[model samples]
Target: MRRNMCRNMCRNMCRNMRRNMCRNMCRNMRRNSERGPTARNRQQRNLKIVDYFRQVFGEWAQVEVVELVNDGSGLAFGIVGGRSSGVVVKSVLPGGVADRDGRLRSGDMLLRIGAVSVVGMCARQAACVLRQCGACVRLLVARPAPSNAAPLQSLGASQAPIVPSRLLADPLDLERRLAEAGHDGFGALCEDTTPTSPPPTVIEESLHHRVRELLTAFKKKLWF
Candidate 1:
């Protein structure tokens, strides 16, 4: 009888330990969920600032010459716009050289690779230039200029072409341009999108699944 009692106590202790662990994990997940979005927004804001600096200042912007060491994964070319308009970075791969340095942004335009000018080169040619740089390479990047302004028509003889107060293109106009270039809506300008909801992270999904499993197990234990 004493042995059976001791065995029951041991099982109870084990059950209690597991319950406590699950509770602790749930609390930690709640804390992370509460804090994650704010941190993410701040990081995104910083990246936007970097892009803004490039856009407003263009080539006149103080050049940031970044030397990236290739680890054989090759440079992540985000988006190369057609007609040599310039390449726009769509996204930087997590943990890559570009991401680690934190200089390259999603909308930054490629200006030059080492001494080679990338101004008029197509996307294929630009990739080739990057490849030739080999193990280590320096990159010059700028923010893409606002492409919204209709080409200023030449005024006859003595008249100056009228300019709009805001040179920044309308969001719809930018979207149309992207569509015309055969982009299936991926690189929409940052200002164009509406904030709907944040996507769930892997950690959040796993935590939710674990919580559901724990609850199911608890229910089964009660039934038994």
Candidate 2:
């Protein structure tokens, strides 16, 4: 009887040991996961894409902008992934100052506005800031490669930055200001060749916008 009891005790002890080991292992995993993505890891990540874009373009690179052009295709999507995920641009108003500048495309990331550097801000936040600042805005951005290649780096900036600008912006989306200004919805650029009164030469504005249109369209189509 004692022998049988001893065997049962030994088995219970072994089982208990295993259960404790598993519990400890699980706890460690939970702790590590809770820590989340490290700051160093995030920094080392191919981030700072806009800053790199600014360098690729000249110190005077400008972002092309059309006012009040969401380019959302009738969707109510908030900003994508995280603000740090991609480059952001200044929002445009419908038939406003920036729009008069030229055909500004959505999805372009804004690098520098006039004298300010907008490297690490969310798109909406950046746009709000731009609207607060009056007059013309100069922006530098990165255009995805023409061949539709999966851009150069994994996360950060691009090799060749693109710059576009708009003089006397059309206040793309000043929210309350838009209502105050009595503006309506916006539309895509017409494919016509009606040469409106030209502003100064374009500082590579369309490149980033064209690339972004592709990305935004692709992602949205996949969702709905």
Candidate 3:
């Protein structure tokens, strides 16, 4: 009877091991199949968009630079929340007309493109739309109060013709690293700078406060 029980136990363990191995293999295969094509497709699509900007917009379309307003909490880098902060026509190339006019220059955050707010649209998406036939765009620039910051505003629009640029041609390797880690967006990877984390938000603070109060009340109770 003892021998029979031991044999059954060994058989059961072997069956479990085999099942686990098969499960792991299937999972790996599925993961590889899904990720491989997905990565390639994303890479191709992004490159195509860049190409379309050059093709459809032609030479006349201007590229805009954006400056981010940093919160007092310090910044790893600036990202357009794609929500609150709006995009502006930061600069215009010379011979493109805006450069000829003194009113439009760098530091102007385009509050609106004609009637459209640049809230949801990214720079790439904005450029794509300009390619449409006879699109007239109106841009509102942020004119900050004259102070120390006025210099950053003076960088102004570019006069150089939109020609072959490095940004348009080559894809950055860092992009793939970002994808493997499951981050999506326009900006590059940011390094965390803070050594110690700051205090929690209001909800967390309230929960901690309540828990401490409950513990103190329980300890003060005369009856166990």
Candidate 4:
């Protein structure tokens, strides 16, 4: 009787454990359904395909959709791929629909063609997908985000270098000013004559020469 009672107790315990496990699982599922997927979860899924793209491209990566309408010419974009590099846009024909659209660019990695995922697809496979696309083809590609670092670097580079106050004035102009000061042996100033005007610059000299020629011509006209 004790053995039978122990066996019945074991069965009951197993049943209770199973019931609790199912109850907890159901509760968790209900909570998850109520909450739905978070925006972060969606973003994470979106980035999963291009997560490593930044590492390869040396810039922040983003996914973009490019739609091209083929007017019987072609997609106007070439693609090349390898196992290491995966499939990427090789070139874009100038003045073509893709170029005009301006979204598709060379070096962008192919992620999808229309609704079909093209990740890990060989170049031939991607080409086949492109061939099968309808007149209006939608492409999903992973591309590098525009780098702000370049503009920042340019700004830093554009800054004029700091110069010493002493070096700021022209050396010849400084010498002329010093000579005008006429420093005596006792460091006493000599009689101050009116400061001479600076020599004319090339542009000023050219203007003066032109004025003289015009004046000479006018004088000759008056004489005649």
Candidate with top lDDT is 4
Off by over 4 Å in 4: 1-54, 149-224
Q: What's model 1's lDDT at 86?
A: 50
Report the number of backbone clashes for model 1: 0
Please give each candidate's TM-score: 0.37, 0.31, 0.27, 0.42
Query: lDDT by residue for model 1 over 145-203, one digit each (tens)?
Result: 33552333332321112223121222233333334544432123333232223346756
Best by TM-score: 4
**Lowest lDDT 10-mer window, candidate 1?**
158-167
- In the range 1-224, model 4's lDDT, one tens digit per residue, is 99999988976876676556556655664566556668897566446434444456543344445778999888789999853456899999998989999988899887567655555557887898788887989775655545542311221232211112231112233223333444211111222221232233643565456556655664565445
Flag regions of model 1 displaced more than 4 Å: 1-62, 144-224
- Higher-ranked by TM-score: 1 or 3: 1
RMSD of each: 14.5, 19.9, 19.1, 38.6
Candidate with the larger lDDT of 2 and 3: 2
Better of 1 and 4 by TM-score: 4
Candidate 3 ranges with C-alpha deviation above 4 Å: 1-90, 133-135, 147-224
The true-versus-predicted C-alpha distance at residue 202 of model 2, in Å, is: 39
Which RMSD does model 1 reach against the true structure?
14.5
Model 3 Cα lDDT, one tens digit per residue, 1-224: 99999988976876675556556655665555444547676577556644643453332232232322223322121123222233444445554445444456654434333333333356654444334313333333333333322221212223211222223222232223323434333123223221122134643465456556654554465225
Cα miss at 66, model 4 (Å)?
Answer: 0.6
- Return whichever of 3 and 4 wins on lDDT: 4
The lDDT values for all models are 0.55, 0.40, 0.39, 0.56
